[model samples]
Target chain A: MAVVKEEEFEFHTGQNRPAGVPDAIQFIDVHKTFGSNQVLRGLSMGLPEGKVSMILGPSGTGKSVCIKHIVGLMYPDSGDVVVAGHSIPSLSDDDLFELRKKFGVLFQDGALFGSLNLYDNVAFPLRQHTEKGEDEIAEIVNRRLSEVGLGNANEKMPNELSGGMRKRAGFARSLVLDPEIVLFDEPDSGLDPVRTALLCELIKEVHAENGGTYVVITHDIMSARRVAEYIAVLWRGRIVEAGPSQELFESENEFVRQFLAGESSGPLGME
Target chain B: MNELFALPREWLAATGEIGRFMGTVMGDVWGGRVLHFFGESLRQAGILIVSSTLVIWALMFILGLICGTEGAYFLEANGAPAYAGVFAAWCDLREIIPYAFGYMMAAKVGTGIVAELGAMRISDEIDALEVMGIDSMTFLCATRLLAAWIVLPFLYLAGMGGAFLASYIAVVQQVGFVSSGGYLLIFWEFQNPPDFLFSLIKAMVMATAIVLVGCYYGYNAGGGPVGVGTATAKSMVLNLVLVHLIGMLGTQVFWGNNPNAPIGG
Candidate 1:
């Protein structure tokens, strides 16, 4: 394990103000590494239940790795990750799979099964986990697709869709199961500004209607402004400040202010 | 000095890793966990039948022709033209067909699996399946192995028929060294039902090893498209070596003591 230099983390206040709600996911001193490059270093944070929380970070700052940890796709090297009262790394494979039923994750490019059309991709989870007939599955699949604005593109393959459409389809697939938690890894990536705002709006509308613990991992300050009810600004694997979205936007910490405001001048710079 | 052994050490490590991965997938099938996705297995079986069966049969037929032509000329030169059937029968059934099947399988199905699953892994489709609470190993790898098991035997049998027909045409029709009836007599005289079974076993074993090796490489593929290409190349090289090894071992074990000759009798 490579030692994290102390001075490099001077602005890492780790100030996690309460979101005034119970946590849906918690990372306790989570340290993850790849070979010699440590991504998450002594990181601890909490995402409150039934709110859209944004994990805001610059590029390559462990934002995506954090989402993997929450879903048990990757485990921490030293610390623990608890999702809805279940320790991620300690659970058996079967148990971990069962626990994953509570999660719906949207990968960056809408990882829809290439073999299936849009409709079947959305219907996949319901068919796997439920005894519902094709009629019922179709109803739920169509409904979710409609919610994501992909209702008319049911028969199209993933490659036929544009980047934003793929993300929307992925979002639709993620919601079909009515899971208790949803994790979106850079939902705004690869989209134009208008589409990003539209996706942010779609996220807000869906959260209002369905109400789950939605964690969006992104660096887009506009997305944070539009979709985040709670915010955690991560840098160098540690949180600089986290709180209600307004509080994080108004934070006094230099790193937090720079990241949230997207300013050029601050403690954060090209390393 | 340490660098001297590094490449071999890496190969050993990779072999062990692939062995472990194959064991887990085989365990999933043996434990009936794969039944959870039986439909997927059936789908894969259908894919194998539709996509690969004819190509395999065509290759086998072509090799059978080569085997028969070579055997006929050799026996004709030796003044035993009437016994050309002996060479054709053994060559087609014992070695040529199985090796051809293995070569085609390694080239087609093994590399196909690596490319498909490698793409899935890179594009996060496998991760998506895992997060959806599916046991991806059972769903993806074990189902593929089971599919190969279910479909390859019948396909191999049919391909053997094609090879036999091609060999008969080459020796009796084209070479004209023996009449059809005489060729049939010598052919039946050289091989028994047990020999047929041994040939089937040899071919099936090669198919199994190819499928398992493909799954191991495909399921664990990383890096990206280039990585997948590398894995596919590695699987092909390994499968070719395994095909010849299994071919040699099968012949030694099945026909070493008694060559099943009717000459002395």
Candidate 2:
């Protein structure tokens, strides 16, 4: 619980525009606090369209909170979050729901309904939102399950699956709607290194085929290195630096260098 | 001093939150989205029956036996054993069965709902529904509430039957203190439609309160597994208090002026 001074945290406080691409999601001076503990303070970043951007941060740095704001789950206390050009916190209930239709979120624990089997879990959005016939739903669900390599595990309950399998099933469910923006919150939190690398590969391969804006929030440097085209390093409720993944990796900022290099000693002391 | 003020403030805030939750549930019900979750509601009803019905029936049956045996002893001692039938009918049909059913429902179904929804809340499934553009309230709480509404009246009826049978066995068969024909005659003489209706209404009202309290605590559960357990406990405690309060209020409103008995006057 190191409380860094607000002035010592250096980062841009507006949308970090890419060279020529429009951002699919933008946060402008977003500030959020729970009780007296502020989690996100004047944080700003842009996730470019049709690119895999990772918001890399240590634990308790509001990475997951950022994802929640993008999906309109949590509104900012005082700033703006725009997803796909729709300003969140300003949308009415109906409009917010309509906005959320464009998003697919894969929670860390999969978040599949415990009562529903894997097939029904994947088919849930389609069944709720569309008048598609059962045969069509089965076809779409089966295809998505197969895409995540869980085609055979359709009848199994969520608790029956291993951690990796559950994450895959969740990934399948997230893509079932063909969402324009997919958010992954700590997709590699509990998996072993081998499973993590495999998941990263699957993400890359899926992004290559789907070509949607993908924002993955993770503290895993290996995942950030392997999957990120753009990277934003958040520290102490602010972005320390952000840019193209290669540029961020080769930056001169002491905090960014220490974090990316996994060094223990730097401006970020152990708190 | 701060603690005293905070307690009432928290209670008022919780009441407001429950009111808002009920409003959302009613809106979803009116919007026809509740029908979309009807199958899920029926599934939950089946689970509730399997989990809570037998225990409730058994509890009521035991209570019936105790009441019947005790009333027969007192009536026989006073040379008015025939009036034992009226006692059994009144207590079982009007007061005991409904109150016991409310208690059982709070202990079993209410706690179960809290635990299930609390676990779902902690696991982020509710937020997952929001991200998928589904109304989690309608899909989760409304479905469970509807299931309780549809199932509890019939369950109460079955429990009443169990109570009457237990009373008959205790007074006529097991105790042999009264003739079966005599007991049945007086029981039928005293019982009427309003007794059944009011009891069902009481059970249904208690069921609604239990479901609402359970959903409120569970859906808003924070922290983690320990938080979920605490929510379950809190729901049960609130439900217990509400069940008794509703039972007393219902008894006053439904049967205060009109006892609706054949021989009471």
TM-score per prediction, in order, is 0.98, 0.94
Residue clash pairs of candidate 2: none
Worst 10 residues of 1 chain B by lDDT: B256-265
Query: Tell me, what's the RMSD of every candidate?
Result: 1.7, 2.7
Can you tell me the CAPRI class of model 2? high
What C-alpha lDDT, on a 0 to 100 scale, does residue A149 get in candidate 1? 87
Expressed as tens digits, the lDDT of each residue in B112-210 for candidate 1 is 998889899999999999999999989999999999999998999999989989989999899998999999999889888998899999999999899
Which residue window of length 10 is worst by lDDT in model 2 chain A? Answer: A10-19
Q: Top model by TM-score, which number?
A: 1
Evaluated with lDDT, which candidate comes out highest?
Answer: 1
Q: Write the per-residue lDDT of candidate 2 for residues A214-260, one digit (tens) a residue.
A: 99999999999999999998977777777789888898877888889
In candidate 1, which residue ranges exceed 4 Å CA deviation? B259-265
User: Evaluated on chain B only, what is the TM-score of candidate 2?
Assistant: 0.92
